[model samples]
Target: MSDPLFEEDEVPTWIFTFADLMSLLLVFFILMYSLSKMTETTLESALSSIQIALSSNGANINQSPRFYSGGGSKLIAPETPQLADTQDLTFSEEPIDTEEREQVNEIANDIANKMVSSNLSNAVSVFEDGEKITIRVDGQTLFESGEAQLSYEAEFIFNKLIDIFNRYPEYSISIQGHTDNIPINTVRYPSNWELSAIRATTALRYFLEAGFRPERMTATGYADSIPLVRNDSPENRAINRRAEFVLQKDPDLQKLYGK
Candidate 1:
């Protein structure tokens, strides 16, 4: 009877303390996970996304993005352009596949043979540096002194060349026009630059008309910058004045050519 009915002890606040502790632990783990993958997160995410898209699981996600996004049956995607680089590239000092190398050589040889058999020996010459090939054409035969108009003989040669290019046009074609040191001045064109450009355009137009792939071809005018020999003599200058149709070599092979 010592007033026991009204007596009570102070209870410990354990429930609130435990909840706060649990919340702190959860936050610490989330932060650790984020820091661990910080450097490579975006890169890994992009690659994983691409891989998943290519897999069977992608079909489900792509068909119903809401399933993956999990936002009230709504799809979530960035509105801005994604910053990711995923380009296929190859790096090799030497030929990794001999079959590809052999095919290139065979193609070049076939072209060289065609040039010789078509009675274009004096006007055209084929040269091969490793797997790269180039067909040199005499501009003097195609142009009249300072003119860029194609002669009848040039038409025949180009006609045949067009057929060849249309058939196997996997190689890059460079049409570079060169000229002697002689200055040129005409009504429509002036200087070697304009004249050379006209010649390149003339040839390029012919190729395009003959159904050659435009992506693999380029038209350029070299003027008298690159000379085959000293322009001291008339014969040497004659050789310098030429138009070259070259097939490009692989960049790697070109670097290691004289090495």
Candidate 2:
């Protein structure tokens, strides 16, 4: 027999459990939302506190995701790529030779040491990628204001560089000139492109005069298109205006050297 005070629809025992579950879920979601709103430092502190509390109670924590460090940028396409062929293709591997790598490293080290020894560190910087190495020279150090001609001091610097290149015949050289975003409308150089090109050509001529093989050398200009940094600040503008001596990759040369 049913209790006299209780109706058929009177609050069921299961309804209390359901309400408690819903309340717990709501609180959990609220805590998660609050965690998201925390600053990096605050989030770290909270995680540390939680970890300490768990450890004191004999709970084992395996690993935590590293939130501070970030990987390098990867190129991402906006949409799925359309391939003309759906067949699997044969792939080949030809890693750079160990000897070639050593040679490049030696050259870079020698150049860096020479620059430092001569107190030209302020005007020059050396950078290396896997396939190539580049020696970048500050534009202001090489030429006068709005002039393409290499200065006397610049000539001295090039002479030192030439001594280094004379040893490495296998590597092809490229003189790349870069200019700031400033507009130039002179009769000689109507645009930044012309100015940049002439500067590169001027440097090329220097190497040629010093007995470098013309076939192994080339010149190119990048007119404010590929700046190292934004041209918003004067310091950044100065950095953007520069020249680079790049050791180019040549498959034929590599093959000749038994790569």
Candidate 3:
């Protein structure tokens, strides 16, 4: 009655389908278990490794990751890159001049003396790096909590800075404002970015009013993105919130003005 090629004990076609279903379920459970064992840091590290591999293979990838807020449908985009508010000037490969290096050192010394004489040695610091100098002033000395308006004490310090900046006309100055990790939301400042920006521009305006050349200076806000220390403690947060005056020798300006 049966065909000659057919076997009486042959496997049924339904068995293959059942086996496939069981295999798929096993794989799904295995994947779920593996994921459950992975910590957040491990997952992030794996992702970073994948990104690096893809980058090495010449794949176009966005470095920033998308962030989502808890219980909110809104997407928090990464901060855009901001350029320094300075003129686009060409620089050569030549080494910094000896006199220029000395001048920068002298400026640092002068700033240090001024801070000590003004009894602000603790609240301010002066640093020199080759032909660049930075004067860092504590945020508390400049402005009140969550406020961009300069305090009365800030004027005296600003006056001293203006005198020094005027004396060194060949230097290009950048006034940078920085904040801590604390969130700020107000009618005027909806975020730390706006607050930091206003603070920087306020200082810039003061300098401009003091007869500093507008073309030689720039103002920018870092908005807590560049921190001096971790914001885990109040003391560290206080240190992170500050303003900096970065000065660099402008060779073109020096040549033009014969300084």
* Top candidate (TM-score): 3
Alpha-carbon deviation at 204 in model 1, angstroms: 0.1
| Residue 236 lDDT (model 3) | 71
lDDT (Cα, tens digit) per residue for candidate 3, span 1-259: 9797786787999999999999999999999999999976667666654543343112222223222221122322223333323322223245678887787788889989988998889888998776678899999889987788899989988988888888788889999999876556567787779888999999999998888778888999988787776666567778878999998878787986798
Candidate with top lDDT is: 3
Ordered by lDDT, highest first, the candidates read 3, 2, 1
Ten residues in sequence with the least summed lDDT for candidate 2: 68-77
- Candidate that beats the other on lDDT, 1 or 2, i.e. the better one: 2
Candidate 1 accuracy as TM-score: 0.56
lDDT by residue for model 2 over 183-220, one digit each (tens)?
55567787779889999999999999989879879999
Candidates in order, TM-scores: namely 0.56, 0.60, 0.63
Worst 10 residues of 1 by lDDT: 81-90
C-alpha root-mean-square deviation, candidate 2: 22.4
Off by over 4 Å in 3: 1-97
lDDT of 1 by residue, 42-116 (tens): 545555455334432113223222243332222233122222122211122454457666766787778778888
